[model samples]
Target: MAYECLFTSPRCVFFTFTLLNQLLPSILGATYHSHDVTSDTVCNRYHKRELQVYMSDPVILETRPESAHMLTLGLSLSCTFEMEAKGFYTTGVVSVVQSMNFRSHGDNCLDYMQTIYEDEDNDMKLKRKKSKKKKILKKVVKAAVLSRRRRDTDDEDGRGPRICGRVLFGLQVDENETLPPPFADPLPPTKPDQGVLSSLFWDAPNPYQSLVSDAAEVDHKGEIKTRLHISNRMLRQNEDVNLKVVYTAYQECDGRRVPESLFHCGYGLCISRSLVNDGLVNCPFGDCADEVDCASAKEANIIAKVLHYERTDETSVWWIILWVLVGLVLMFLACCGGIFLFMRRRKH
Candidate 1:
């Protein structure tokens, strides 16, 4: 007998697995050496195929800027995707877009023109003869008029316009199979300063900061959706910016529940909240549990004492009854000894 399973989704890749089973009837009194012979054979035959077809049609669909017009420097964007399998995946995308460099231009262009004209007039009077004074004055007047007209045309409200420059936007996605990173995985280790362009602009507090790293999860239907919130300080007015999203997909077979604290042991293991500060080494490495969570030896000792007391409380009543029975038996023996003494005295 043969069986075929088909999985499909829109904007998602589909994977198909085929299994073949052949069972033979046993004769009377025949002995079977292995119970898993058929299953083992089937697995051996299809293992490579299963791995090859596991992920198919994985793609990033759209990368779009959230707004076309921004008064400040902040920017926002979103990336949507479809994947073949549900698992852990990671991707880094970067976009280079134009933004206004407000610091490059002065507020008043008229003041700047006046300073240039006065300096030029003083230099010309000192260098020129009387015969050439009229010609020099005519040339200066013509040049000043042209400069004023150009400045007026450029600055409509008497303030100079801002200059534009290219800005780099970056986003990183790290996702888990069962739960989102916030719930399933520990906070990633702090990154070192590698002197890359992205690292130079990665600011923690500023939303319009050039680089951002985030995590996301693929849904059951093999899709991932996420948004990036940008600061108004990162953008220019009515500017169109480019966006790009890159990604990679893989699978995780371990079936471990993520703890509330979301700490991981680095080797695909989750650290239990109960085990933290309990003195016992739950994580394979000290750093995996985080230095702050595992810092105090006194906390672990206190936790151990509390656990011991809890166990003692559970059996306290039984222990009390046993001790009372022993005490009563000793009392009965004493009474018997006293009665024997009195009987001996009376006999005498």
Candidate 2:
């Protein structure tokens, strides 16, 4: 037996021919493939538009050089993301990782230890003097008590000649009081061993530090900013260091399921490509309006104004000083001339 089937849709048409049920599986497979292709095409267009929004404004990462003799401190790594004026970034995570070779041993410690020792010694001396005074006061109090008791017993109030309390109490009297133990000498600072310094300072050859921004969100026209601090203990001089930043953005589509591949603005907001540079904030949170976008142009304008004012101020200061000096010289010359004229007139 032979059978024929026809299927029609606005965008798709399918025709099938089968002998009994032998061709049924092939027909079903063809329909399934067509559906999948249509779905993929739609998803691709959506993904491309979403990526354009994210890539419109680039993220910036910057680092400052840190220097230290024995310890390097405050090596700062900054991550700046330019947000659209009206756009917002939904909940996202930003991670900053820094890796470098740090040395555990350095010769500068010798100089550093000298200054430390001087301060420690001065403090110890002051403490020792204070302790000595306290001990002397304790000794004086004990001596005075013993002398008063001896004199009081000598008066013997008719009680079969009162004996000295010291003898009655069977207490041995020492002519001199024993002093309290002296303070122990401060231990000298020891030099760290070069061979084992690395082991003692760090556990790994290349140490890496990471800063993560959890629950990070940017409002419409706001910035996503974070700073990573690399301490001197983690950095060494003349070592190559690398820094990396990773960010994941969240988007909201008003309850529509966003494809996993599409980039989104935070707080369930969808970002549009036309929003970039449109000067209108679209992100519900206003995370897009911060200075990250158009930072170069804004910074240039600021720098120009600052430089102009600085130069003008400098020039004005010099001019004022010059005029003051000239007036002083003129005044001195006039005074000298008047004195000379007065002397001549007096002689005449």
Candidate 3:
């Protein structure tokens, strides 16, 4: 009966660990509690761990003081889970849900997580044949029932909203950091809006009391799905590793309700959220604004180190340059001496 009540009620949220007390970016000032899920906890048939959800509080995005020009109107959640796949099932799914007390009007929400590594059995991906095949797929969005679709699903029955999406991350943990060094991928940017603002209406005069009276009729919550598949080849029957899970939120009202998620390249330009770490160089070629700290980039660095192909230190580089210069000077002098001898012999 308690399980049934938890599913039926909106106020009672689920978490693996204790609550996280922190202030998230809001259109108006608001606070949120963090929740967690792990492999050991059982919730549903489709997922291995229970859903990590943000407490039912409307975090109104407001204009940050430093960036007064940018008024934020939506919230984002990032969840980190310690993953060990020894005795547990070889495959599992990790889920995170973002429920809103107010109505959300667009498809601006997307999910991302740490990258999983795939390579040959020798050591790591250090010595795979050079091929164009991608080792890991970082974007995990299999099936998502967002704002509108979720509302319709809830109407049919009093049951909780059905939320499902793509597998999050697939990993193989070993004693050695042989597992691909985990890194966060940037969430894709939302499409540009028409620069207009939509009117957001709420009931109670106090922003806090504006929470929807009926939990079943709520329309603005979404679930992010990710998967972890452990391989017997990589683990030693009782090994576990830690991985990161990230969730990004965007609100695409007609006007700029929330600022577009952008990542600063540390250079002069700010690129779209999707552009960051998408593989193709969007910012300056070597600035590494979009490429550095990415999963693929970090993995490549690790592979290079393992293969003994990493770049040499600056001192070694300068020494090589000096040797080349000295060699060039000696060759030039030898050529001059040979020309002088040839002229003298011809005259004689």
Q: Order the candidate numbers by TM-score, best to worst.
A: 3, 2, 1
Off by over 4 Å in 3: 1-221, 231-234, 237-240, 253-348
**TM-score, candidate number 3:** 0.22
lDDT (C-alpha, whole model) for all candidates: 0.26, 0.26, 0.26
Q: What is the C-alpha RMSD of each candidate to the true structure, in Å?
A: 34.0, 40.0, 29.1
Model 2: what TM-score?
Answer: 0.20
Task: Supply the global lDDT for candidate 3.
Answer: 0.26
Question: TM-scores across all candidates?
Answer: 0.18, 0.20, 0.22
For 1-348, candidate 3 gives per-residue lDDT tens digits of: 464333333343222111211122222221221122222231123533323222212111111133211112222223222222111111111122212111111432132222111111364334333322422211111111122132333233223232222211212223232323322553223332212211121110111011211111111222222333221222223432222222222222222232354444321223335434433222221223345632454333211000011112112344367556755764565566567667777999
Off by over 4 Å in 1: 1-57, 62-212, 215-223, 227-238, 253-348
Scored by TM-score, the top model is 3
Q: What would the per-residue lDDT of candidate 1 be over residues 1-348, giving only the tens digit for each residue?
A: 011111112111111111110011011111111111112211133231111102211222122232233323443221111223322231211111111111112352111101011212365565544546356545654444344332233333222222122211111211211211222445333322323322322111111111221111222122222222222345444643333222223222222544453344333333223334433322322221422333332134423111111211322364368556755764565566657667777999
lDDT of each residue in 39-148, candidate 2, tens digit only: 22211322310111132222212121321322344333211112222123332322111112212234221110000001123765666467664555545543442332
